[model samples]
Structure formats: C-alpha cells, structure tokens
Target: MESFFEFRHVYKGFDGRAILHDVSFDVRAGETVCIMGRSGVGKSVTLKLIMGFLKPDSGQIIADGIDVPLLSEAELTQMHKKITMVFQSGALFDSLTVFDNVAFPLREREHENEAEVETVVTGLLSMLDLNDQRGDYPASLSTGMKRAVAIARALAARPKAILYDEPTTMVDPMMSHTIADLIQRVKRQYKLTSIVVTHDTSLARKLADRLIMLHEGGVRFFGTVEEMDASQDPVVREFLQQDELALP
Candidate 1:
C-alpha cells in the first residue's frame, strides 16, 4: 500500500544541535503508529515538521502526496485541511465555550453555516460525552476534558490524519485511560491515519499497530508491538523496563 505519510531521511536541528537524525518512517492510510521516546527526543518535533510548523534542516516530509516542507504558506493552510494535530496542552480558545471551541474549526475551515456547524458540533460533543460541559469554558474544565474538546475540534475539521502530542501527560491514570479509549474509538470509527507521540508504553501498547522508538536523535527500533516486546536491543529493553516501572 502507498504511504499516507512519510519521513524520508529527515534531519532537523536547532542552533547546530541535531534533534532528529536521518529519521525515516512511513504511516500507511488507516494505520496507527506510535513514536515513543523520552522527553526532548524529537517526538513533538516530528509532529511540528509534519504540520509544517517547522522546517526540516534536510530531507523530505510528505503527507497525502504533498511535500510538507516545501509547501508555501497558502499551500500549508490547504494541506492542514487533511491533517490536524491535537496539542499536548489542549490548545483551545480560552474565550470560547466548549461548543464554540469545537465549532470553530468548522466555521473557519469548512465554512459551514451556523446551523450545519451546530448539527455537527452538537453530535460530536454528545458522542464524546461532553454535552454537560458544552456551555463551560476551557478554564473550568479538567485537563482530560480540555483534551477531549481539542479532539472534538480536530474531528470538526474532518481530518484524514491526526497527530497526538504527549496525549496522556500530566493526567491521572483514569483520565489517561479515558483519553486512550477515546483515541482508539476515534481511529476505529474514522479509519484515521494516526501518529501518537508518547512515552506511555501502556497507551502505546493499546493504540499502536506498529511502534517506533526514538533514542539519541534516531529511530532505535521500529516494528510491531510484539516485536518491540521481544527485542533484545539494550536501548529498546531500557524503554520497556522504564515502562514497566511506570505502570501501577
């Protein structure tokens, strides 16, 4: 199958310090791939590059047949219609209510009339179990709720692919499980091509069709979750060990 997204020999750096070195991977359509790594290991950077938020120092980043790094500002905006990132911070509009926050994308991107937007956004909020919070603002919601709103907003855009950055961080285990299940449900429901950047092995295990472990600025391991578990590579083993300790 043709790759829906790809990073071919991707190299990125800041101030002469390399962050991603010759990183290469392909995510086929409808497949979920988890990019696992410790903090500051370019997990989020990969998403930024994919989103055209940052340019690669060298190498190609392709999504949906467009060369991401080469897209112009206008072109990038158009490309964004097919891909959306759910930020770790749940970057919702502080001033907008949950319903409006979720509707913003449809209003802005899809230019859906208010009635149509309301129909879609209301269904999303109801489906996601945020109906009670629809009138609430972001500041009043819990971290998990904020993240759910962010997911709703992403879904409003009707993206073919979604990038999740450190999705379960700073939340309690119950909330993490809730968010994980949400991700799983959305992916299965939409048949989305997904890239989840996380260090949470449990989340990775639950969500990934394949896993890529990033270490020291490169892909240290890339294979199925079962292969990852059975690997003898010291680096991969170290991550697994840390993951074991992280579990309750």
Candidate 2:
C-alpha cells in the first residue's frame, strides 16, 4: 500500500512557542488514524499543517508524493481538492440555507448543474438525516444538525482525505455516538483516508484503525487500541482515564 500522507521530522512554532517537535507519521490510503491529546497540545495544529494552513518551521510534509512546502500556486490548487477539513464549529453561513451551504463549493467551481448538484448534495444530506432540513438555515438547526451540514459540505468536493477537527465536541450524548457511527459508515462506504484530531478516546476507539497520542510537543504513543489499553505509562493511562470519564 502506498503512503498517502507523511510528516517527516516536522518542527513548528509560533512566536517562539513550539507546537510540534520532530513529529513523524505516515497515513496510508483508506487508513483512519486518530490524533489525540490533552487540550492545547497542538491537535488542531496538526490538522492545519496537513491542510496547508500553516507552514512548518522545518522538515517536510509529503501528500500524494508532492512536497507540500515546495508546491507552487497551481499545485496547491490541486492539493486543495485532494483534502478537506471539518472544523469544530461547523462554520456554516447563517445567511445560507442548508442546501445552498452544501452546494456552495460546487457553485464556486461552476461545474455542477442544478440537477447534478441537487442529486449529490441531497444524497449527502440524506445520509446524515438532514434531507428535510435542506431549506433550513444554520440558525434553525441544532448543534448536531449544523455539524451534519458542515460534514456534507466537506464531502461536496469528493476529497481523497478528510481532516476532521474535534468532530463530536459540544453535542448531546446520543448525537455524539450517532455522529461517530456516521463517521465510521461514511469512511467505509467512501473508502476514504481520514485523520480525526480529537482527545475523545471513546470516539477514537470506535473509529480509529491506528491511534496516536501527542504530549509535550511530541508523539507520546502510536499504536493500536489494545496497545493503548495495555499501556502502563502514566501519561497514557491518565489520558485514557480522562477519556473514560468523558463518555456518556
């Protein structure tokens, strides 16, 4: 199997404060890896780096055999289509209706016809059980529905990989699990490469094929769920314990 994404000896910082130090990892096609950490431990930064929102201070990031740091403007445009991000806040436009929100990306590219757009966007919205809310604006939706709309919008581009940042945060208990299940089904059904960044181990356990934990500006552990459970390291144990308490 080919590696779809690789972070090699990456070091990054802002204003003399380092967020990542020599971090290295590779995500293969169709792989789902969870990057978990305590709050403010650079979990979101990791997602941003993969999305090319921030340049690393040093080292290399390779996605689909293209060097991210060396990519020209044209190359960056192609890379943008290969990956998409699901933000923590859902980031919907209060002004746009849900259907239009999902169709926004398509409209920007000017390639999809109304029928084509409706077919694809409606399918996505229906998958997340938001078909009836197509005309509803973000202001009318609940937190979970807003997230579902955001997720549908992200998938509108048919990206090869998705960077989900704190996908299940700040939702009801039932909705959280429902979203987790939706994520699992979506990945398998679409054969996607997913990198979910969150400290929520319960969600991680349900979705991750491999698990990685970051602490103190480095990857403290990278392994399977069984290995995580068996880990006797104080930090790993503590993190998992906290996760257990977080479950509904």
Best-fitting candidate, measured by TM-score? 1
lDDT of 2 by residue, 67-153 (tens): 888877787877888788899999998899999999998887876789998899989988988889999989988898888888889
Report per-prediction Cα RMSD to one decimal: 1.0, 1.3
| Per-residue lDDT of 242 in model 2 | 79
Clash count, candidate 2: 0
**Local error of candidate 2 at 38, Å?**
0.7
Clashes of each: 0, 0
Predicted structure 2, TM vs. truth = 0.96
Which segments of model 1 are wrong by more than 4 Å? 109-111
For each candidate in turn, the TM-score is 0.98, 0.96
Which candidate has the top score in lDDT?
1
Q: Model 2, 235: alpha-carbon shift in Å? A: 1.4
Error of 1 at 204 (Å): 0.4
